[model samples]
Target: MNPEIIGQYLPLYGEAAILTVELGFLGVLFSAVVGLFCAAVLYLRVPILRQIVWIYIELSRNTPLLIQLFFIYYGLPKVGIRTTPAVCGVAGLTFLGGSYMAEAFRSGLEAVPKIQEESALSLGMTKAQAIRLVILPQAFSVSVPALVANVIFLLKETSVFSAVSLMDLMFTAKNLIGLYYDTTEALFLLVVFYLIILLPVGVLGTVLEKRVRYAGFGS
Candidate 1:
């Protein structure tokens, strides 16, 4: 109801929204890379290293993401390793997102029939060639829906970074509330901002899921 107050705080909200998107975008990109790499390593059934990767994945998946963020932003300094909150937030989110992302990829990889590999081999493709050319593409395609879901979750999870003093949207909203002493407008606007950003994404996810499923890549 306070147009002047809303107008004054609009720039802060916009800047914070951009930063939050940037963090989520970077986190999603790196997490995808990490996820694919880990998925590949597991698919190959590498000795010893596979076990280590499993432990890392399990640890990441089982623990709360907040604890992981705390460890990166708070605990690492105790070991004489230091980093900015931005760096720590991105790293922690990437690590946590990668675990779940890898599982999505792993399911896709396994969904790819073993016979496809055999067929490629029969055509004189090397083992690596078979996997690279025949398996990875189909597997990744089949995983599109799951990947989209993971990305949505990852983006939402970025809100947690505000806990570490990251100037994300939630942090900005909290600051505005402090400044205006108006929790109703501040919090309501915060929800509206998130809805504005996420609603389209949710729609896109649905569209992509249906398209991929119909194309036989998301079965």
Candidate 2:
């Protein structure tokens, strides 16, 4: 490993890593919003809407993200639903993350005490009011760690965005190798980059998990 190669390749890899984080951060933010809404829908047991939410979750969760990305980038545009590569990457990742997160949030909602809802109803709250006030807060409190972990997973999964020309870290690393031809060094740096990005996330998730558990709404 020449320090000279590091000087050249590292900058490209760093840029790539930044792009990767940017893409994932946007996608995860969207997913968190979508997932929470969908989970709330299912939790509230809306007559027809919960079924639709279930279908959405199942379809996205069952399919591989690669195929999802392909369809978004290639398949949809054939029918005129065109978007830029970056937009497509973000959409695909958000859909993908949203599905998985719906399940997590749903599971957390299940852990809430049954009496909580009953008590809310007795207090003359509407279903929406009860859920918004009573259930969701508790559910979200229980699932913070899972949400954080999934965010980290989504962060790593953004590497797939390179295939769509999103120029994320993995894509940047490959480009770096093409320029520098130092496979060992470039690939090694790729691994190190992810470690740097994800380790702190993982540690933070664990700490948050401990806090949630100790706070008594936990598993």
Candidate 3:
């Protein structure tokens, strides 16, 4: 717990934290889109696409992010498809997060009563309009908690970005410890940085969940 050492490496950790956040944000954004699409396919029972989405969801959910990153960053190179570590990190996160998010969204969709859809349609709304305007809003509200949880989980998974040499927060801490043997200080900083990243998210999620529940959208 050397003050001087902590001071010296704080900037490095800050930079790494930004990179981790950037990668995590991108991953979560893309994964949400992928998840929504997959959930829609499954919800609508879209024939061939549903089966493909199911297989993808199973494969992604079953595999580890570490292995996925390894494949994207290392294995892809051998196949003549190269990507930067940052790209690999984002891609891996999206691939893994998508499945979890899909399940969350699908559950949300299913929780909405069938009568709701029927009512929307009986109002002369097109099927797509009913889904887009009526169903999705309620489903999303019901999904707020799970989606927030998935976001936090995916952000934490960014820790493994170091496996691909991405120089993320974990990588910075490990590098500092290896170079200076300041294990205690480095670990302290690591925990602090992670808190800095995740604590606000946790609090925000709670706030959103309460709001959703208060609005009568959550059970």
Candidate 4:
């Protein structure tokens, strides 16, 4: 509605968007590592570690990112464990996203027939070699859709980074509204920036999913 106002605040939103992307990217990257490790533990059915992974997955999935951020940013300080807001944002996102990604990867791993592993082992491949060479590729293909969804979900979850005092897009928008009382303009820019950030990811995910399906990964 207000082109001039929108233009004026564009730089602020841009800066916030950059921070959002940086933090989201880190969170998702670390979450994938965590998820893969946990999924591997579960898949291998490692003795005590399997139970621990399950507990972690349930706890992370059950809790809200907001609460996790609060605990990290506020509660941790009580125990003398201080962390910057950016760190808190990334940590919370990783904790939350890892669980979802673990499930995605676990489902993908399970979807692969047991015979594939057996065949790989029969061919004199060690267990690790069989998993790395034969199983992971196919499982990852099956996981593309879910992994894309989790990536998008984790990126959107960055919206709550403001709760940790990060000057992310949501924070910028709220700050603008508070300062200028430009509710419509602020919200409009918020939606526009969010769309700018998320739309391409959604499109890319769709494209990737289709390719994976065509390659005979998932239904």
Candidate 5:
């Protein structure tokens, strides 16, 4: 709590916060790409792909992320796969967020009226054309809020990277505490770091939700 110690520590904490922001940004993007594709498989009623998507979702959604990260860090090498801790952290966050977000997309897809599909069919639109032109726009509009929430969750989930020895904000905080031997100041600074990393995502989510509501969805 000493002003001098905090003054000395501020620069390091700032750098660590930047790293945490990068991790959250990358993790959310990875999850959205993977989750949207998988969710589309189920929504489109792709025969074998639907089954595979379900299996993937169930396996990932049911497992704890810490265990998943451990497996990625430890078990991957045993099975002849190797990736850096940062890579594994991204993969872990992607799988964790993708499973949950896919379900949200699936639900949103179901919310879009089937009449729209029939209308497109009567106009001789191909399946892909109908889905792309008529369906996904509405589906995504409906799902935007949920997607934002999932992104926020993904951001928080990146904390697991610290457990695997990644030098994210949290890992830096732990090191600072150990090096400085001041638990209260180190932890207070870390909490500030987390808030700086995470609060904007919350504000962004609210803005996105408002945008979605104004888009003629949930009317």
Candidate 6:
């Protein structure tokens, strides 16, 4: 309703939006790496590590993300491990998103045909070589849609980081509301900024899904 009020906070809102993107990007990257590692361990049936991975997936998937964030930001301080709000927020997102991603990747790895590995073996490749050269590529293709979707979901989930004082978009919006007492304008801006960020990501995901579908594993 008030143009001056909205304009006054636009710069800060922009900064918060940028910070949100940075956190989401970092969170998704770390989570993807951890998820892939966990998936590989479980797929290969690694002795003790597989069980540990399973437990982590189960616990993380079952628990509330808010509690997980609290433990990282609050509980760790009690254990003599102190980190910044950003670090704890990123770590929390990584672990929480990684657990869901692990399942998607594991299913992808399992979907790879056994004969594909056999064919690689027939070519005189070692098991590791076969997996690296033949299986993972196909598995990655199979999992792309799911992985992308999960990343999108995790990006939205970054809002929860506000609880830890990370100045993400949602936090910035709330701060604006507190300062200006203009809930409608602040909330509208919040939705608009999020749409700007997430719309492109969603489109990219759809494009990736179609490309993977049409190209098939051979591509």
For model 5, residues 1-219, the per-residue Cα lDDT tens digits are 787887787898888777767766787787888888998888878999899989999999999889999999999999999989878888888888888889878877888888888899899999889989988877877888888778777777776788889887778778988887877877888888788767887898888777666434343
Candidate 2: stretches off by over 4 Å: 124-126, 214-219
Candidate 1's error at 217, in angstroms? 8.2
Give the higher-lDDT candidate: 2 or 5: 2
Where does model 1 exceed 4 Å of error?
214-219
Runs in model 4 with CA error above 4 Å? Answer: 214-219
Estimate TM-scores for all models: 0.92, 0.91, 0.96, 0.96, 0.92, 0.95
Q: Tens digits of per-residue lDDT for model 6 on 7-100?
A: 8778888999899999899999999999999999999999999999999999889998789999998999999999999899889999899988
Clashes of 4: 0
lDDT per residue for candidate 1 within 66-149, as digits (tens), equals 999999988999999998988988898898999888888998999898888999999999999999988887887778888988
Clashes of 3: 0
True-vs-predicted CA distance for residue 174, candidate 2, Å: 1.7
Clash count, one per candidate: 0, 0, 0, 0, 0, 0
CA lDDT of each candidate?
Answer: 0.86, 0.85, 0.93, 0.92, 0.82, 0.89
- What is the overall TM-score of model 6 with all chains considered together? 0.95
User: Sorted by lDDT, highest first, which candidate order results?
Assistant: 3, 4, 6, 1, 2, 5
Which window of 10 residues has the lowest lDDT sum in candidate 1? Answer: 210-219
RMSD per candidate (Å) reads 2.1, 2.1, 1.6, 1.7, 1.8, 1.7
Question: Candidates 3 and 5: which is better by lDDT?
Answer: 3
**Residue clash pairs of candidate 2:** none
